[model samples]
Target: MLGIFGSARKTAAAMADTAYWQLIIDGVTSRLGPAEALCLPARGPSRNMWNWHSKRLHPYLPSLQEEFRRLAAYQAREAGYADPGQTRSMTAPGRGQFVVGDGAVPASPVRGPGSKTKSKKKHAREKKEPGSAESDGGSAATGGESPKVAEDEPQANPRRKDPGAGWHVEGGEEEDGGHRVFGPKFVLTSVRDDRPLSRIVLDVRYQRPGKGYGGEAALAVSMLMDAAARLPGLTGACWDGALREIHRDQLMKAGLLIVSPQHDGIAPRRIALVTGCPCGNRHDLWSKGGALREAESLDTGEIHLTPTTGSRLEPCGGRRHRWYLLTRLSCGNTHRERLDTTREDHRRGLNRTEHLRQHPPDTDSYIHCYRWRPDAESLNAQLDATLWNRRMIAYGAPQQTLVMLALAQNALTRHLHHRQAPSTTRQERAPP
Candidate 1:
């Protein structure tokens, strides 16, 4: 809600009306959205629509975007708690329902932002020596005679202008399948559905790299924190490899299991080394190396060396050390010890998000929970389908957020209605 302050009084025309705001939102959602979605032809009256949008709608989008965020969050919250018996379409969530967090930087499909923001490719090209042939040819071409304008190679990114857009390149070298993606990214959080082709989007975030939002992983954790309580029986979070130790610890504290198939980095897969040691001095072995051996009345304690792959349950040769769970060690039959995070946090901080799960890639969980991560991509594809390149009818972070919220609201509304329609129909058809 926008607060109006100051003692100055104004006519109704100058005042903010919540009702007018709702009306404009509904109009834009129903007509303008369907029109622009998937590049569908926009069908509506011309004169009134333009006047209402330009005079009445455009100015208030910034505020309405926030309201729309509230609307979507509230609606998704209600949808999650809906009765399973009444809404047959709702996934019969179990004691430990899973949620997934994903993010994507949709190409802005515009040209200007990249020209101003992209410096990697430019810098890479600039690394050439100043006295090199390409530089000399450039100096010679600029002087005396008319400069020759060589036709440029086709641009990999599309062109249009949206303020605040940036260039983010993904993957490896260009020749080895690397490519440039230009735009602001959006992160989405959603509950996994057992019913095929069905998932409820809970929240969305519009972001740029290093903009205080803490990238995709941070945004995902923020969403899980908010959604954890509203969602009944939330026990595990399925995520990609981008999770960090701090973020993972946060979710682990909230009583959630993390399952990620990809490794976080080339770093070792151990979450944290088990505390206490056979040496009795209690020094922890962080890196892959030897266990220190100690003996009373000896000159210097001997060093018992071993590879990292040695059993965590027992030392290399000195004495046995009890590790909670060694690297890539399965929880085995009973996973209860891990359910209580207080018991595990101090001992592990390696690859688990335990929020940014740094599990070795292609692990078994990938077959079950992790596979559902693609549902997020499906949702993204649906949103992207509506984009022409990546430009939308709305622009800017706030405006982009509003578009995302609107689409999410529409999807939930339709799904909720479908979920409840059968029961409503049965009541009407009964002998009343």
Candidate 2:
């Protein structure tokens, strides 16, 4: 086990897997050395013990995840980072920053207990249509030590029935051509409020992505929603093109706006009537640099957004949810355009699962926080530094979450390193 994880000066605490990390006040250092914050101490409980507790601790997963979020929020608050009204750029909205999020599937693939020890697609069925295992339970926000699964559960034919571990087919489409993964998958969401290296975790389901059960778009919305409570005065978001008019409308309902890229899908951007004053110049909606500066109305000067579509019943939403977002002109003197937020025309079909996005392609808001959106690649790199093969060293999502929250404690220590990084520059500039 030591060789697999490489040797670390590990502490003799193997039974510390089931406690809320925010409550652990002992053996914690007040300051983290840079060397310590960047590396993972290779300490893992036995596989059987981890798997058993993963099952036992599944019910308490949500609160435990919440505890970890509070821990990160506490670190950010202590370092003076949870403010939405800070400034770092000449173009960023001086008002605040947005909660950025993204999802990833690593090289870590899982196999059924009955299958061979090989990791290939031949044994794993290629799911053309969507159908994945239902989430047994448990959610992990950030990347964690994806522990090994030996399926050591004591059951009759345990190989045939593993809880929560299942097959998930991602991109095989021509657009993304993503990957096919089977095992416990996670979205690994993040929230950074005006500070750098802030890995504030958002709750993401660790279920397989198929049957449209697991998509990062839903996770992105939930991540922003979660960050809203923790980081006050969050003004807007800049995500990949996964967001739509409905998502933008929802965020607007929450007093927020998203300047994310628009993807030309089965439906097009909102159509505008040419019966207006400045309706001559129409910008291509899907290009990277297609957006123009928002224009004010020739009449009122506040905002020129006017409703063009009608309200309708929201899909899958019971009597409660409705699609009130209609085609509205881009306000100000910039002219007229709509977001086609109401999927009024289901041309071909709603390609709701095509992933990849950025802030409205080439607009100013897109450039404002291009680096803010924490995508899968960055999180996967972090895991690569921590675990071998960039995979979780834990089994089920709950257990993987414990590993994640435990690692999230590193954020506190890492903040110390970030705090002292500029003191050297200060010394260099100080006149003796």
Candidate 3:
């Protein structure tokens, strides 16, 4: 049976037309579901199926992986896997299944000839800015005044200066002889389970390195939203730095990220219009006629919603593109303060070092979520382990096939274990 299964996988991976093999897999899965479908193999001398499956399904791998995860979750639920707490415990300080995601560089370790190295010339001595003195002796002519010394200021030690301070290179400008096999990058999503080091892959995507991780993260977030819908309560997701921009956009779109502490718990309720009256008479503000439109920040990052409230609430100046935070005073004087609607790559709550200092990484909701993102690496490791060789044995098998196979196994195990555990209401109950 083992030999047959391996042969079938190899044959399926190498096939020219993966549609036929996919059809067969679909038939098996439709009949048996994910857990069982993964166990059984098509009985035959399978040949060239792996390559066919990879090539055929490569284009649709992200969607296919998402669909498979949903199916696996459904199947696990149907099989008596009942862990509703994954979502419910989200409100707690440090609970919930960590949906950690990251991008991995799974390359074919084949190295080619040495890449050319370029030397960068330093232009620091070429020219000084207009305000700067030409030389230390010319400080008087340049209107340079002696530096004031503060009593509380710490003395700088010339001997203790950083050796590499003047030798630093500009970021992203350092020449890297690109990897010989800078193969297609892959994004993997997984959950941190208590059982072992291995993590269960929830979704996987393949993209060329240049495409970036933001778009891929958006897809993973969509998958997470689906899971959250199914499970409910708290579903925290952790993502690597590459997805920070897209992650923030998704959070803002889903109403997960909020600027105001009072409105943090409320979803889909942005401070549409903050109207402050000087008289301190509190009045509710409603969206009379504002269309959510895209706005660009000064830095060229895309902002999903323009701060403006449209003609109905447009300020007297007709600058309808600005978001305002209103300050209400006791005298009925309403003050409108412009609100920033710019999309930033960093999260205000999580990225602020001062905020992190107060909340700490473990206690901070966003920080805690992101800290677990490294678990996705364990999923990558598991994938490599399962793929037989360090790399994928078959073409197409790495992205979705191997991932789905691992997930199916995980779903089964989770279901079986949960099935035997006492029900929520009957926990610690005497055995029947």
Q: Which stretches of candidate 1 lie over 4 Å from their true place?
A: 1-96, 112-160, 170-178, 211-213, 264-366, 412-421, 424-432
Sorted by TM-score (best first), the order is: 2, 1, 3
RMSD of 1: 13.2
Candidate 3 has what TM-score?
A: 0.46
CA deviation > 4 Å runs, candidate 2: 1-55, 85-91, 94-96, 106-109, 112-162, 169-175, 193-198, 202-204, 212-214, 264-270, 274-359, 374-376, 409-432
Q: What is candidate 1's lDDT per residue for 1-432, written digit by digit as tens?
A: 111111112212223455544554565566668454445232323433433454455468657654554554454444443222332211122312567767766666466432544345455455878776555545555554423443433445544457645665444335546576667777787764455534666667776756366677787787787666555345456776556556666665654555654332343222233334333342223322111111123346654322233122211111211112233212222111121234445565433333223222343333455666677677777666655433444446655554565564345444554666567543312111
TM-score of each: 0.54, 0.56, 0.46
lDDT of each structure?
A: 0.48, 0.46, 0.40
lDDT of 3 by residue, 1-432 (tens): 111223345444544345655666776677668887677555432444443554566677557666766764554343333255533332232323445666554433222123232222112322445554643325566576544323333323333222111111111113532233333345565554445533345555554433353445566666666655554332356554343333444443342321111111222222323334444444333221111222334466743333232211111222122323343322335445332234341433322111111111322444544555556666666555544344433333343344334334454445455556568633221111
* Number of clashes recorded per candidate: 14, 23, 34
Worst 10 residues of 2 by lDDT: 3-12
Flag regions of model 3 displaced more than 4 Å: 1-44, 47-63, 75-94, 109-181, 197-199, 212-220, 255-371, 396-412, 415-432
Quick one: best lDDT, which candidate?
Answer: 1
